[model samples]
Target: MSSSLLRRLSVGLAALTGLLGTSLIGIRAADAVTVPILVADVDSGKVIYAQAPTDPWYPASITKLMTTYVALDLVRQGKVSLDSMITISAAAAAEPPSKMGFKPGTQLTLDNALKIIMVKSANDIAYAIGENLGGSIDTFAAMMNETAVRIGMRDSHWYNPNGLPDPRQWTSARDMAVLARALIRDFPDSHDLFSISAIQFGRAVMPNHNGLLGRYPGTDGMKTGFICSGGFNVVATATRNGRRIVTIVMGQPSPRERDVKTADLFDYAFGQSAGWTSPTLEALPASALPAPPDMRPFVCGGKKPPAIEDGPGALSAPGSAAQLIGGSAANSPALALAAFSNPALRARSLPPRAPLQPIAVWIGRNPAEGQQILESQEAEQKAAAANTRAAKLEAAKAKRLAALEAAKQAREARAERAQAAREAAKEAAKTTAKPAPKLAAKAGRPLPHAASAYTAVETPSMPEAKPGKGLSKPAAKATAHKPAPAKAAPAKESTGKSAAKKPAAKKAAAEE
Candidate 1:
């Protein structure tokens, strides 16, 4: 063979190799862009289609469904009532955009809060609810986790009540399917909160983030979520012919992709019948799921054209399936009504959402009757406490009065005893003051007795008195004579001594 022929063949083979390499690169790029998707029967919990359904992915605002679920549970348990007002703290008000921008101290009833959250996907409102019902965000998160476990959401963990971009806030499509089913089954009364197309707050009317509500046929209710890391996610529900279905699409490249994909999943599920044999959501294996992919760079900083733009008022008619089911050029009610005129779309479009008669909420206004109820409770407590204190004081006063009465009786008894002792002492003193009777003479000197002295005086008076003298006069005279004789005897003794002294004086003189 000629060398030139060999060179020509080599060049052709090189061109073929280059083309094959380019085609393989394109195929790899397409395959690498997989996302989590799942569709299930709302009533039976059976999976209709699954694509990496157990792979972990950031839940984004879809976490609010769990937040809503926990809130509804608390409401059912009477821990929080629909009319209960939740105050907005600074932390809750400070959350990033896609929020209500309510100032700290804003107050909203549980019912109003849920409506705003569902319609606006307001981050601040979600935070406020978690803080209010859980008493703190952390506690609310615990409740979310407990409820998730109870409902068999095995591959989900919650870091915040609002599905903010936390590295740890992850969930799987299968787990979300479990949650969506649980929300419908457990709290049927709250089902209306999710289907509301728009809510009016003061002068502002905020439409729901779930685009399917007004556009997709049979789209009844559910929620949507997004963060940079988890491009855009949606957990949507639709009903047809009395059969309900749930579809979950996570980590889509754009909101349009998420919505379109969800619509496709719903279409596929509704078209099936009883002969399908896919496993139920619970029967699917959930082990060894992949870690959530970080789409932050692609979502936030990419220069490439978006696969689908989800700008406001940019709702062009989607693919044939969407057109067949009443796809509209824009997400307006008028467009939705116009699109519904097609016979093919009429049976699929959800009935017009009921006008929202939202419970009143405010940023700084008084909480109305809720505050009054709280104040009344406090006042009653204070009054009860005061009554208890007064009762205690009255009891103490009664006890003191009894003590004083007993003391008074003791003093009176002591006084009586002292008086009796004094009387006895006086009697003893009188007895002792009486002179002892003179004992009969037992010694040489006779004791002077009143009777002996009377007898002696009487005998002396008898000798001198006449026989006929009266005894009374004789006794008086005798008493006077006894004293006179005693005095005369002393005088006579002195006179005799003087006589003897004179004789002795004369004899002494002769002797000298």
Candidate 2:
């Protein structure tokens, strides 16, 4: 941010003139003079009569003055032609009442649309102009804020293009008065559009809603609006006799009261035309007024809206404020005015949205409030998780039971196969044993003689030994008949004969 812009924003501190002082201004005098009164000289931008000009107030329909000012600037730059046709969109068609009854497909020139906005306080028409010119309401609002800053409107902010009551939407009457002054000064040529007392657009004739224009003489044009939150608000100006003065009355109870008080103010201002001095105005003590309720800031578009640059010669536009919009050759003032008289059908656009900022949250008492909320959420999550786990466990148990049943069936099949295998083995063995004995019988039939001899040999016994001495008596007799040895007698035979003769002689002698 530039130091100058910072200095401008720092001016917000001056806004804290105390809500108590503000409350005192709302009290009416015996003459029914109530609330903040700010009377200003339009040419000099000097405060002639001020009670609480700085005190905050809802700007209401007075915001349209700025809208008109920006539109006229575009017209001056030739970006928007006065007769350019604006095709209303669904979003613009959907704005809450105070409308021109233009359906979604209805079309109007830029000039007529401004007429509707000024006379009818038509939100739909205002949105139509913004959307057509700036692309969207949000984008148009950004341009509005930037324009406000450039024109030195410090105590103001715009959230929407139309001045509908949004809690976040707020502007001070002083800032509004500044806007009205700028409109009159910047586009003297376009000022007649505001003073139009009646407008007839395609069979719809709506009288100008500003009562002051018709009731108060020399009251040429301005705007008036009322919302319950904003009360009765008006940005009124008149060129009377020779002097032009602008009056801003906000938060008044009703339109009749606001108009009547404004008339009284104009009378006072007109009376002071004779040699008014600064010291006399400063001698009046400072009077306070009731501050409007704080509008809680809200962001539209459900999110932070995008920012947009202004078009041409505007701060947000490309190059410098004096430069024409790119691709525009209509540079001469006469050519530009001709283009504005008959603009391209596509030039209407929306205001921009508020600038993005950090979201602010208020904290309450009880130090553990955030923690308690977190804990409660955690408990709920845990319970849900437990239920999920139990469901999974039951599914797993069912799967296990199915597997066990399958295993049992497999075991029975295996037992049946084993028993069949054992029976087959037994039958095979019996068949093989019968074949061996049959082969043996056939072999015996073929070798009958050798078989018989084998049988006789098998019958032969081992020889026994002969009996010894313990044999029978017939064996003993055979052993006694054995022959004896012969005598040796040759020599002895002759000797024996001789001896026998001698023995015979001796025996004869003995017998004698």
Candidate 3:
């Protein structure tokens, strides 16, 4: 490795952040990162240069290389034709971004789908091709594995048709290089599919993710993929001096780093003497890494989701390697003279890209048919949006109704508790109550009737008859029955016989 690369890789990320200052905002660390690099000729399977080429690593979007191979193979087998219409299934439409956004029922030709996936890397388009060709993703993945094994891939497994962050899906640098060779060798007619700089669908233009497509000289065709888990990866090819070289790079910290390193390796391989002897891609020793590294922390701080770029300007067609990408390859050095003993092979800067030539990619059989599909998709999207709105409104109304029902239940519960309390009080009264103490019958008198026993009226609190302070017991007893009737008798407080005597005495006194 050039010392410039070593210097960049060796310095701690915290220190690099201090160097670029604000310019380093989105820079990622490739430090201690396992990178798999391979450069081999297209005609001969011999590798000119390699490092950890057989290590297990997440393939990211390069899985599309296999996707393209399978689609082309099916076309070759006459099982399907490129012009056949593929109905976008619901599963296809539901995939995450980097997609064509075609509705579930919308239809497009397989030819158009392949083009879109090659340049746009549309996850949805790749998936639709899989479903239409192989019946489903599971079946399609089996097809991918079968094709991989047939093509001499030793350390690769695939799950999804679009390589969207699948832990189960992985491919090594050698495997990718081998797959790229198969793509170039088997389908010579479809070479343009990989070199499209940009694809124009309707008015929107999407550039290919492969950085070297237009910037690097004689660079023909390839693919690039990124997910936080897998970092940045590419399977690229460049033809110079009647020689075409396929390069595979995996697990670089950023797209710029991946591109620069690939370009550097290309420079090195192109300069190497013809006697360079190295193992064929298939014969390289396997890496001890049992599984692909989770690169989220090093590449994206382990937080950002897949398919997001550091900036909006990336993935442009034939544009300057702007900033770290298309602008000057300033971030990647010319490999300062001291970094390299061989003065000729230092990493070179990428020039501002030639103006982008946006290749027109449309849907359906022709531009007119593609227009109809686009209009239909728009209508369906509107309907889907309206349905989504209606669902949200219904959900809100249901939530309100549920709350009202809960309140009603709470009120009923309180009323039930109150009724239960009243019932309980009545039962307690019955349980604790004793029949009014039976009035003790005095001498021989019959006990008073229940109603008369506790009357509402009460007796006078003071005595009616007055006695001398010191009267003999016999005298008091004699006077108890025959009290003297004073001339001014106090009016009786009761209406029984006591008040009648008071009235009679008053009347007698008046006559007198």
> Which structure among the candidates has the greatest TM-score?
3
lDDT (C-alpha) at residue 416 in model 1: 94
Candidates' C-alpha lDDT = 0.67, 0.57, 0.70
Give the poorly placed runs of model 2, Cα more than 4 Å off.
1-34, 274-291, 294-512
* Superposed model 3: Cα runs more than 4 Å off: 1-33, 274-276, 302-349, 376-512
Q: Mind sharing the TM-score for model 2?
A: 0.49
By descending TM-score, how would the candidates be arranged? 3, 1, 2
lDDT score of model 3?
0.70
Q: Native-vs-model 1 lDDT?
A: 0.67
Q: Which tens-of-lDDT digit does each residue in 15-110 have in candidate 2?
A: 212211222332221212223456777876766666556544556566777777777778888998877767788888887767755568666667
Error of 1 at 243 (Å): 1.1
Residue 509, candidate 3: C-alpha displacement in angstroms: 49
Q: What TM-score, computed on C-alpha atoms, does each candidate reach?
A: 0.56, 0.49, 0.62
lDDT tens digits, residues 272-353, model 3?
5335466677678876666665555445542444445321112211111111211112222222111212222233346666
Query: How far in Å is the alpha carbon of 381 misplaced in model 3?
Result: 6.9
Encode model 1's per-residue lDDT on 327-434: one tens digit a residue.
111122222222223332222333354444444343323455545654665698899999999999999999999999999999999999999999999999988896
- Better TM-score candidate (2, 3): 3
